[model samples]
Target: MSNLVTMTIASEAFLLLSFIIIILSTKNPKRNVLWVILFIIGAAPHLYLAIDHVTNDYMDANIGLGLAFMFTWVYSVAAFIIAIILLVKKKRDNNISQEQ
Candidate 1:
C-alpha cells in the first residue's frame, strides 16, 4: 500500500477509536465496545493484508505468518482481558446496586 493509504488508514483508525471511546464512555458501564473495536480494528487489516500477501506471494511466507500470528495473538489477548475486566466490573456494579 502507498504511504497515503497507510496514513489514511491510521487516521481513520484513531478517529474511529476515539469516537467509539466517547460513545461507550457515556453509555456502557463496563466499556466493552472499545476493546472489541480495538481488536477488530487492530487485527483485521493486518490479517487481511497478511492473507493477501501470502496468497499472492507478495511477501515472504514467514513474514506474513509472523504478522498474522502477532496481531491475532495480541488483539485476541487484549480483547479477552477486556472481557474479563468488564465482567468483573459488571459483577461489582450488580453487587453494589443490590446492596442499596
Candidate 2:
C-alpha cells in the first residue's frame, strides 16, 4: 500500500475513533440519537472523499484532496463544539430545574 493511502486511512480512522470514544465515554442523558445520526451523516461525505484519495495511491495528491481533508477537520470541530455546547446547556437546564 502507498504511504499516502496509509496516511489517509489512519487520519480518518483516528478522527472517527476519537469522536466515537468521546460519545461513548461521556454519556449524556439528555443527548438523543439525533446527534449521533447527525454526526454519522456529516462524516460520511468527508470519509467518502478520503476513499478517493486512498485509491489514487500517490504521495502528492491534488489540491482537491486537501479540501476533502479540510472537510473532515471542519466536520469534526463543529461536531465537538456542538456537542460541548449541548452538554453544557443540558447541564445548566438540569441544575436550574433542580434548584427550582
Candidate 3:
C-alpha cells in the first residue's frame, strides 16, 4: 500500500502491456509504428522511475531495494532498445513496400 509498491506494480503492468502490444503489432503490419509508440508510452513511467532513482541516490546496497532498482533499470533499457529496433525495422519495411 506504499507509494513505491504502487509505482512498481504500475510500471510492471505497463511494461507487460507494451510487450503485448509489440507482439500483437507484429501480425498487423500497418500498426507497427503505432504499437512502438504505445510501447514507449508504456515504458515512460519505469524510465522515469529509474532515472529518478539514479539521480536521487535511492539505489543502496540493501539487497531488496538494489534488486528492484536493477530490475527496473534493466527493463527500461531493454524495452527502449527493443522499441528502437522495432521502429527502425518498421520504417525499413515501409520503405521497402513503398518501393515495390
Which of the numbered candidates is closest to the native, going by highest TM-score?
2
Summarize candidate 2's per-residue lDDT along 1-100 as a digit string, tens digits.
Answer: 4765776676667566546645654556456465567667766766676677666666774677677667777776776666566567768878999999
**Model 1 segments more than 4 A misplaced:** 1-37, 58-60
- TM-scores for all candidates: the values are 0.53, 0.59, 0.49
Off by over 4 Å in 3: 25-62
lDDT score, candidate 2, position 21: 49
Each model's lDDT: 0.55, 0.66, 0.62
Q: Provide the lowest-lDDT 10-residue window in model 2.
A: 21-30
TM-score of 1: 0.53
Point to the candidate with the largest lDDT: 2
Candidate 3 per-residue C-alpha lDDT over 21-73 given as tens digits, one digit per residue, 9 for 90 to 100: 45653657767677667666655655565556645654455354446556665
lDDT of 1: 0.55
Using lDDT as the yardstick, the better of models 1 and 2 is: 2
Ranking by lDDT: 2, 3, 1
Backbone clash pairs for candidate 1 read none
- Flag the better candidate by TM-score, 1 or 3: 1
